[model samples]
Each structure stands twice: as C-alpha cells, then as structure tokens.
Target: EYGRDNGIRLSAVWLTHDPEYPENLPAAPLVRYGWTPRGELAVVYDRSGKQVRSFTYDDKYRGRMVAHRHTGRPEIRYRYDSDGRVTEQLNPAGLSYTYQYEKDRITIT
Candidate 1:
C-alpha cells in the first residue's frame, strides 16, 4: 500500500509470530503489487503477501523475473550499482549473471 501510494517501497513488514511455520510467517493477508523505491519497479509483496521478487524491464516495460522471495527463504542477497543498474543476479541453480552498464547500456554475459 505504501509503496504504490507514495512511490516509497515498503522495506519491511513487521509482525508478531503466528502458529504457522512457513505457511504463517506473515501476520496479515498478503497483497501483491508493484513498487518503485527510486524508479525501480519491483513486484513486491505479491499476492498472498508471502512472496516477493524483482526483475529487469526492457524498454517496453516487460516484467522479466530476475530475482524472487519465497517461503523458507528468510534471507535475500542482491546488489545494484550506483547508477541504479543491477550488478548481480543470483538464482537457485548457482546460475547467476553480472551486468556491466556503460553510458546508457548494459553489457551482460
């Protein structure tokens, strides 16, 4: 709600512990939506409010799944360059990629 309403991405969703393990981690109903903290659109707090993930968008603004948050995964590790470009993308397969951006373009291998 706060992310879209003011363009301020909600960093944390603090809540008390519930009787559910991985199923009840969140204390409230999960609502998915788009978020932009600094003009970076993130599919944060997706439906069920239990999952979150980020991706890169092409010029056409298509959602490309770059990273994500899932149940049983309590930690997230990702990085972006000073120019608001993704420097690293980590996936479960250990298949990750680094981006090298130079003057309005991205170089990926």
Candidate 2:
C-alpha cells in the first residue's frame, strides 16, 4: 500500500535462509518494484547493493526487462506497442521473436 501511494508497486520478492548453514552466512534477499507514475519498473538490487536487473517502459507504459549478467552485456530485451502488449523479444542468443496481435487472437513468430 505504501509503495502504491509512492507510485511504485511491488512485483516480486525473494528471501533466503539456510538453517543448516553457519550462522555467519550472509543473508541474500531480492525485491523488485515497478514505478507506477511512468509505468516503468524500478531497478532491483541484491542485499549487497549490486543491481540485479532493470526495466524500461515505452511511452504508453509498456515494460521491457533487462536482466543483469556477471559478465558481458545484459542479453534480454522486449518491445511493446502502445496498447501495452509485447510486440517483440530478443534473447541472449540474439534471436528475435515477433508477436502479432489480432482482435481475437495473438500470434508469435
């Protein structure tokens, strides 16, 4: 509720606790949020303060995600239409997948 009021929405959360591990082990949790004001996803960071992933939004508020990588470049991207539908996606291998939307159906190519 507080997040929504601040124009941010919680999308997902991950928590980890290893009971069998040593007590000195560090905790690693992740949280993701979406910026509601401009309809973009805010960056998610790990407990160590390193960026986990980030997102971009189109003019109409459609979102595209770019996952972080330890090395090389982030290798996933998406494009959306004005109606907030995903129109295309690019994978790590650089393969492009296109989407087609019809009044009653959606087709992926």
lDDT values of the candidates?
0.54, 0.58
- Show how many residue pairs clash in every candidate, following the order shown: 3, 0
Instruction: List residue ranges in candidate 1 displaced over 4 A.
Output: 1-67, 72-76
lDDT of 1 by residue, 1-109 (tens): 2223554555444444555665666655356556543455565565466445544444333343334555455333455665556788776656667888778787886
Residue range 1-109, candidate 2, lDDT tens digits: 1123343466545444556874655544454443535555666665566666555554533344433233245556777687667788877776779999999999999
Candidate 2 colliding pairs, count: 0
Among the numbered candidates, top lDDT falls to 2
Q: Model 1 scores what on Cα lDDT?
A: 0.54
Give residue 3's lDDT in candidate 2 (0 to 100): 28
Cα error of candidate 1 at position 101, Å: 0.8
Output the worst ten-in-a-row residue range by lDDT, candidate 2: 62-71
